[model samples]
Target: MVIFKPKRRVCKGKEVRFEITELDPFIWLQVNSESHVSYSIDGFIIDSQKKINGIFNKYEYELGTTLDVLFETLTQTFSQEIYACASFASILNTEYRIFIWPKDFPENFNIQDKLIISIKPVIKDKSIDLSSYKLVNMSALESGIKKLRGYSFSNVKSLLSANSNVECFLANNTGNPWPGDLDALIYLKSENKTIALIEFKTHNKNTPISDEYIGKYGKQDWRRFEVLYNLQNQLELAQNHKPKIFYVVWGTKDFDNHKMIKIDIISNNKVESTNYLDRPAFGESSMELFNLLLKLC
Candidate 1:
């Protein structure tokens, strides 16, 4: 919610410093790598730790367990040897702390002091206060990851150019928590310099509009609608760029007027939905899917 000015740290062409402090149940680190590595580490668990002999240790937490879930996310996000880690061992005890100095850093890993890394304040409950955190780590919500429906907002930008020659991607790292992402942002490389904001959805099955689909009291389709509304607002609030368009891209088993009729009712005619039967999994089919997105744009 706040943009702190970058404090320039002269690395002097040398390795910069980063640290992960022991904050009990959660580990906190400042992102000072500037535009290069700071954004990459935003929602990552350092992935592994280095032994004194410089060997990387793999996480052996039980599969599908909470620890395993966190580690799996780390594997997907980064391939670096940042040595930033969140281990069950640390949660069980208070001994492990991360302090990255130049001599101890990975070779050829560039570091800069100009980057501003904001550390979130720890709550008494030992859980992260998502609002206080600058970066929105979808992995932080182990269960909610499924709610993303295996969609990647990044590919919208990447695929469009390859398929349709229109440039698009995440506007900027808002650092907002889960459900606080700008689903799709596209750039039209014309003289006007226009951008588009898109909301994408994918469902296994299309349930009819009723209490089963639109209730706050229990499992309902309205929950997804609510998240879309929040993401829309987040994009509008954070984006200062002008000449923007809003769109909704849906991939579902059933794409009929009956299903969308209810969606329009819930969206209050504020959003537009484009339905497709061949919805690709997250990070896949950037070429074809984004080609369709270009038409919608």
Candidate 2:
């Protein structure tokens, strides 16, 4: 909902209420109440940026000038926190800006004399059963594909590029790529019109191996190496660069390290390191499946 608050009473007559009247696509204003009483805009401010900008007519008010406002939001585990691009406008020589505040803001907060307000996404009541959201035994690639099933291909690509959750992709009727036996497909947005074939693998402690597999790296390394070799071969056979291959592998153990290549399967270091330096062979964690796809770019 949008609210507009004036520092003082602006209506001259005995107007006690006000309603917005739209003049055009870019013009809007408030007028006297239907009962003809002076309206008092003292306690609250308009909560919407779109409505505020339309009513204030930034272009008309500033007459070809603009103001920019910048801010960083508290980080979240599953979403973007920083808004790299934001802009404001001049309102009666005062900077008027809009943004979504951290969800932790006090409920009693009011914009009364403040020049900024956040435009947050309206929360809609969920009608689906909570039990339907239960997790299952699924591979990372499979999970990502499931999350993107109802979203547009473009939206999926954008979310993957931004390293955002695929569950956040906007739903649409556009064609969505299906996951293959190896990996999911990603369509490039450039003029080259390339299709990215990715292979996802993880070697976490929970990974299961066959008892017949006897080696330092065992079956895990063999599976990864086989996929890597096949992808490399595909890279060579690709025509007009129509197809590209990428490997997204994550785990505590390093595949390229000498200890793994040798017959040393046991690790002396019991403490698992949580930090990861930038490397192509390993990802930060097993969670960022979409991020690994973006790294392929």
Error of 2 at 135 (Å): 31
Q: For residue 162, give model 1's deviation from the true position in Å.
A: 32
Residue pairs that clash (backbone atoms under 3 angstroms), model 1:
9-113, 9-114, 31-117, 46-84, 134-175, 157-168, 213-221
lDDT of each model, Cα atoms only? 0.26, 0.24
For each candidate in turn, the TM-score is 0.27, 0.21
> Which one wins on TM-score?
1
Q: lDDT of candidate 1?
A: 0.26
Among the numbered candidates, top lDDT falls to 1
C-alpha RMSD values across all candidates:
21.1, 25.1
Backbone clash total, candidate 1: 7
Writing each residue's lDDT as its tens digit, candidate 1 over 214-292 gives 3334445344444445333433443333323333323233444224312211243333442333433433333444444
